[model samples]
Target: MRETLPILRLLSLALLAGVSLLSSVALAQEEDGLDIGEAPVIIPADPADAGTLQPSPSNPAGATPEVDGDALELDRRVRDSQPPVMKGGKISPDGEADQGINIYLRMGTPLPELPPERPFADEPDDAYGAFQRGLFLTAVDKAMPRAQLGDPAAQTLLAEIMSRGLGVKRDPKGAAFWYGQAAQGGDPAGMFKYALILMEGQVVERDKKKADDYMRRAAEAGNASAQFNWAQILVSENPGVRGLTMAMPFYEKAAEQGIADAQYALAQVYSALKDVPKEKKDRAREWMHRAARAGFDTAQLDMGLWLVNGYNGPRDYELGFRWLSIAAKRGNVVAQNRLAHLYINALGTSPNPVEAAKWYVLSRRAGLKDVGLEDFYLGLTEEQQKQAIDQANRFRRG
Candidate 1:
């Protein structure tokens, strides 16, 4: 099945739950980073014995128990809190303005980056090769010895298998143990995974301090996602200029690595910093454009507006219309509203009342009401109004 934004969000939360570390590793690979040998653990639709897994007597008191179904549901609720802004203008769930700085560009906390290639890359053929080929039981058998011998890769692979119940019973506690070992063995990915487990307090005791330390280690070890997240933490805890200054380099590093959210965050930071030179402020537009081109809908909306209004450069109505159209098609209410205005005013193209009315209706349905657009719609002839509504319905269906 094709992956949707909602599905990806759920998967991300699952990563936070420490049950899908391999999936997170695979995502890092897509960013052209280090390769952890392929082990894309698919979440089974009906995991075998999912109902039978229960917390052991050894579980820490007051720690959340991890029943397979309950864990999945809890992950879903966590994901729902950070819903994708299908119609809302906000960039992310956590985004908000503070001290006159617009910090809505950064998304949620970052996940771990893929650790550097394991030193035993060539030697682990039996275990990794078997895991990659779907022989989960065989892979586990081969990996166990190396894992016991303190191989980070082997330990991580075992963690992945145990967490997902691949050819074995699901064992989140066992997964947590292996992940901790892998982290201690100097694996950046393991540090990230183990950190998340510690933070969640499921299967392992909650230790916010320990989690922060592990996250810092992962970030310093060159995990781009970790760098972005750690930067966010630092900025949040220290909202002063000094704090932002400290976070800047990490954001820059992550942005340089092609993290679009990081690029958006940097753009906001540069744009909002007081007393910055004009050239420096203009750099915000550059990063915004980069992020927009990389598929960040919020940046696309901002870029379109900036281009249309000549905020940081000469006005380019045609280019602005293009960007606005791209975001509008992606269901951005603000973009749709702006696209309607552009159509009505013939800013980039010939005025088309029908198209304008269609966009206005769509935007209005998404909770953006423009009085002028409403008046214009009311003045349209009955036939034109009917045609506009039909077009709006078609767009809605698409």
Candidate 2:
């Protein structure tokens, strides 16, 4: 019996590895409610509760969440189930009512991830290595001799340095010249930048045909940004499920290369298109989770509701609450409002009126009005209100 006891102990320890485990033990645990915990709490989506969320409140944002923004206007019933619409180069929510379905263009703020600057990607020579180390001036000096001798890779290095004004006066025209030379020399990064310059017309000339050619070439050559943009162009030109089908490959490519925007777009393609296969639709949640984890706030917001409403799979209210909390912390107004709902209703957490009010206060200050949140505030005690305000103030100071 003692000898057999050690064998059992060893077997139990081996089960912890998960692979080649004892099925009987697993079955026992399953029957006893083990696994990744029980099936999550689910809130069914009522289709009748659609197209009623009033996003974009008229009031300009205040410095901090206020007890009162304007008159008590309570257009606060949030809903899902709105179809996606192709509008103005964006796959937007059909009515701007699905709080998380609105996909904004990655514009105005420049994405720092564009134009790969890895010193070791190809030429790990001193010049490229110098650029990697923030020695931009040194990079230019070492790269110039090679650049003058018509080295396209070196030319690309010079273009990136000049364009970003890393260590020298910003000379976009000079960068354009270098980029053009590199493009001619068959550099994918150079081609992508040159294509953008041509399209912008301000940096060079607005030759869209030429720009399109260059972009296509760059995309085919495997520039992640070019791949994503090329997909957008295909959608804009074709404008339907056919266009989406054509562009899916490029979006997949870009998403695989860690482009968060591309990941979110892929999710939208799967979810918004009714013609998508059930297997492919299942991928929407996966891609959305990727985008959200990559810090795309909108994706995070959507992931929260999707999990709660079981849009893609079974509900997991705990994870949904977590994602919504993350977006709320990052200052997503809609998330803040929705998170308040979660908190007050005890969807994924214990009902804490104070925490709910705190989140609502943040959203209200950001120019979003929620009548339900207002009523929630009115119901809180004066002490709870002060505590909520204080909590919000701490978040503000940070």
Candidate 3:
């Protein structure tokens, strides 16, 4: 509701299918409200026999939507791979924190800056080798000498180790200092880390101008995270298509480097920008599909709807249904709600009153309240309603 006029003027999801119009959502929610839409108008199977769910005559039973070879390959890829771009510090499937970044952080005041260099000789397997093998303390010891000698790489290693607290106490202040040093010495990693620290203003004095400089430098140096984040920052600084246009190249570069978030951004860019070339607009399909396969649940939700409604190309209800089912299983509440619609309408698979109600129940449990689904559930027979409830209760998100 607080969105700017420029964002409101941009293309909305309504252009895709039955989705409502919404301005370009902000990035803070991590793509929330970017793809999901309300349920389409539900045409009863037969007005005369409203109790039974049936496909509308226009959709036709046994509608054999053509199978796409590219889609088949995409299915194979998404089905086979684990999530491609897990952020550091997030818990994994097994609920263990990613030892990658979080393990290194200990929330405390920064240690005092190191004294002048001691006579410690460096080795081929110096700080980096030890750090890679999880020897955080040793890495710090080895890196200190070279860092004091103004080696950017060694400074970067110390910064990372100190920031992550890799087998050592987290020294945010020390990390900030080393990160700043490494950035000054032209290390991309240091630039990106230091830029973030500067932005946060907690670990050091807040310096937005310096943060932007380091972020831009790191992005130009081809750090994928830096590229995606820099694009987001650009969009934030200059809203609307003008901002998006300026950010496109960086988004593309990041996407090409396998950043799922960037791929999703490009998909939005092409879809929302009306003046884009036909070929470029068409790339939206590829980008959306790629992002979905990379475990971006929002992309997966949109790809399903796009395929279902032929927004990208031919309507393939079956493929859309499969994708929606996948996202629903992955605990996307919007996907769950839409999957319920698919079940009731028999868009992709055979309809079961129980399934439609069950999906609605699951989505409702997640706090995605849908009045349409409420009515649909209310209309079910009591016996069927009980079955739906049982199924919903038994179901667990995969």
TM-score of every prediction relative to native: 0.63, 0.65, 0.69
The residue-by-residue lDDT of candidate 2 on 1-398, one tens digit each, is: 00011112222222112211221132123321112211211211110100111111111222321112211121222222233454544453444443322333244554346586657443246777677656677777777666656666776787777777666766777788877877776677778778878877886777889888988998798877778777767766665677777878887888887777678778867765667788887898899899898777767877886676655667777898999899889887777888888888788899999999999998899888888789989999999999999999889421
Clashes of 2: 1
**Predicted candidate 3 versus true structure: per-residue lDDT over 1-398, tens digit per residue:** 01011221122221221111211221112222123343332211110100111111111122222322221111111111233334673667775557755434554545457699777463354567666555556666777666666677776777666666556556677777777877877777678778878877896898989988998998898767677667767776666667788888888988897777678778877867767789888898899899889777777877787777666566688899999999889888788898998888888899888999999999898788888889999999999999999999988877
Ranking by TM-score: 3, 2, 1
**Cα lDDT listed for each candidate:** 0.63, 0.65, 0.66
The prediction achieving the highest TM-score against the true structure is 3
Task: List ranges where model 3 is wrong by over 4 Å.
Answer: 1-125
The alpha-carbon lDDT assigned to residue 101 of candidate 3 equals 51
Q: Of the candidates numbered 2 and 3, which has the greater TM-score value? A: 3
Worst 10 residues of 3 by lDDT: 46-55
Q: What are the runs in model 2 whose C-alpha is more than 4 Å off?
A: 1-126
